[model samples]
Target: MARGSYGRGVTSTRTDRWLRLDGTTNTRDLGGLPTVDGGTTVRGRVLRSDNLQTLSEVDVRRLVEDLRLREVVDLRSTAEVLLEGRGPLRAVPGVRHRHFTLLPERGHHTDVFAVEEADAPELPAGWAESILPRQVAEDDQEETPAVRSYLGYLAHRPENVVAALRALAGDGSPDGGGATVVHCAAGKDRTGVVVAFALAVAGVPDEEIVADYALTAEVIDDLVAKLASSPTYAEDMQRRDVASHTPRAETMRRLLELLHERHGGPRGWLTVHGFGPGEQDALRARLRDQQPG
Candidate 1:
């Protein structure tokens, strides 16, 4: 709410963990969240955000200099990246950028339009009736369209998902010392799913993961408004009511439940998808704070 300078050149306000930036609406530190084993996630290690295409110089300084960000895991499709171009962070020295889109690389799935549909107010016409009936029949109809979309990320481009996790696990970092920001458009669906899996691998509790995903709702209006002003996402944002953009906790909860039901858990899913135990441990080590003896 309050708009003041938070640090050095960062002209933004702080709303709890949310980093109020001049360009982005839903950027927050994934720190101090409780894990199942009595540990908490360490601050400055990971952050989740919406688009960074419009980040001001001050915002860039805050993320790179102040937060010591070393990596950015961009989850947007190839078309989204080509259309939007890399943002300000791309030119900054020492910050690595990796694009691991969680969508099919070809056919009907390789465009910004299809990426937008992942979080559309409703499933595209007949989508639920056609592609998702098997999941519905198998999962007792517990999957919301949003949940199904999230699961589709696993089914569609699981390698990208695992690659994103590996990037977050300090793959390119000097010693896993700097922060990594994971983001997609609006930072609600793709970013949320990836962050959820990262936190799950870090041993964060299910409720905390869901609560973190739902935090996007607090800034849903601003997020939608910001994207609506952008030419690339304007049409999609204009078509959907703002309420439809607000993420529901139950959607994330069910996603996690189904992940466990079908794949043992996030860790198991990652393992099955080729992430392996060593990589999972590295990711866990990168995300979790050391518990006191």
Candidate 2:
């Protein structure tokens, strides 16, 4: 596969994985990635993206008509949904939207997408302090804070994770059936974790999963800038440096390693969390292309 530089010393396989659109910079099809069994993922079966609040009508047509997007597995919090409303896709027929927020519901509205800097006053008190430190102390000392944060998503909300996986699996259909797009605010952290699990279940190698996660780094600046312009994410974006937000391969690599160490890998984690073998097979079948005889 041809490769290209995404700056910041990150180079990704240039397989036309990126889905260029007028609204978002980080949207890409999770297709053509090499799986463990020597088969590649089917194109258009699943997509990972940043926010869709600003998608143009043409963007909608491109996704809804051209891509045949059947479901949107939004990983945003209740506050985000309430603040962003449903966007234009809400009006589109035949498209289903499912919200399975990976954040623990705190009764009051919290900006779950916000950069949980220790001193960010705009964030609810004890937001980062409450969960992050504990997660870091419990996990491997070598794990990056980002890795710990990703684990926190699974630790705090296994039910949501299982639900999101079920949504991705969606009735095993050959011929690369209708697509499902998963997104959060910037499609880096929350979206990356969920998509990583799905791809892992599909038998994509750990390096491939890390590479796919790091692809977001290629457009990290664009994603941050776009979200920074929004009232919803502006404060959080301003609080953190852009470099800190770049999705490093090491971060995801450590995350996958931790999953392996703790839960016996994605399959093990899914099984423990109620996804079970039948559902796992469905998801694998949904995302994997049939190998030739």
Candidate 3:
């Protein structure tokens, strides 16, 4: 919700009003949020969106000039990069772009997820209590990517998450008064999780972060439709997308709950996840002010 007139498109869905790029998927800025403290997450300091694969001339102008975007962090895989075949970012004069597949090594996470996705979504929460567990057990362990992929996602704690954070944390601050935008293909699963951590570092409130996580889906409904039609679509993508939109509000609550139940809070979640002392403080300094606002 970056205030100051993000010119509404000719159409008028509350969702469509937020749409920035037609060809590019899941593009939206994380502005206008009132952080835990009094001040807001400085508008124009950060923008989040999808791939730059299909950025048009107008789209590039808006991104580089209007938004004054300094850097673009693309989280898509090498294979996806080859498939999509990107073009130059329209010579904005000063913008820089870099790619770092968040869950690096496509072999581990994506491979495991492809084998785990089931044909359909899980039963509604309350219904699962009665017989879904038994149904799932009988259906086969391979049918549940959330159980399998999430485990591998967590297991890669040894590699992926920590490495992704390091890359993000090390990126130089926004250049010459411009902001930075980070995104992956869909901008919901891996991108969402990592961006959530980034906002947390920036001192955004937990509620605001959750709201932001949900916001990407609202703005990029078309991408969801496209993914459904994608030739490579599979069960794991279905399961991951299912887990992604699962609760609307439920997933965020659950992540926060798990963090609280085990460690102290989001900070605790990072500590336990193997982000060492120096790394933790550096991230905090980047995201939070020394004095509590």
**What are the RMSD figures for all models against the true structure?**
9.0, 6.6, 10.8
lDDT digits (tens) for residues 250-293 of candidate 2: 89887777678778888888899898878877888888854211
Ranking by TM-score: 2, 1, 3
> Ten residues in a row with the worst lDDT in model 1?
1-10
Candidate 3 per-residue C-alpha lDDT over 58-169 given as tens digits, one digit per residue, 9 for 90 to 100: 8777877787776666665544544444445725558765655543342323321123223212322232122212223332355344333333344443345565565555
Q: Assess every candidate by TM-score.
A: 0.81, 0.85, 0.64
Alpha carbon lDDT of each predicted model: 0.75, 0.77, 0.52
Winner of 1 and 2 under lDDT:
2
> After superposition, which runs of candidate 3 have C-alpha atoms over 4 Å from their true positions?
1-19, 88-93, 104-154, 157-177, 228-247, 272-293
Which run of 10 residues does model 3 get worst, by summed lDDT?
A: 1-10
- Give the total clashing residue pairs for model 3: 4
lDDT winner between 2 and 3, please give it.
2
Name the weakest run of 10 consecutive residues (lDDT summed) in model 2: 1-10
Q: What residue runs in model 1 are displaced by over 4 Å at the alpha carbon?
A: 1-15, 107-142, 172-175, 290-293
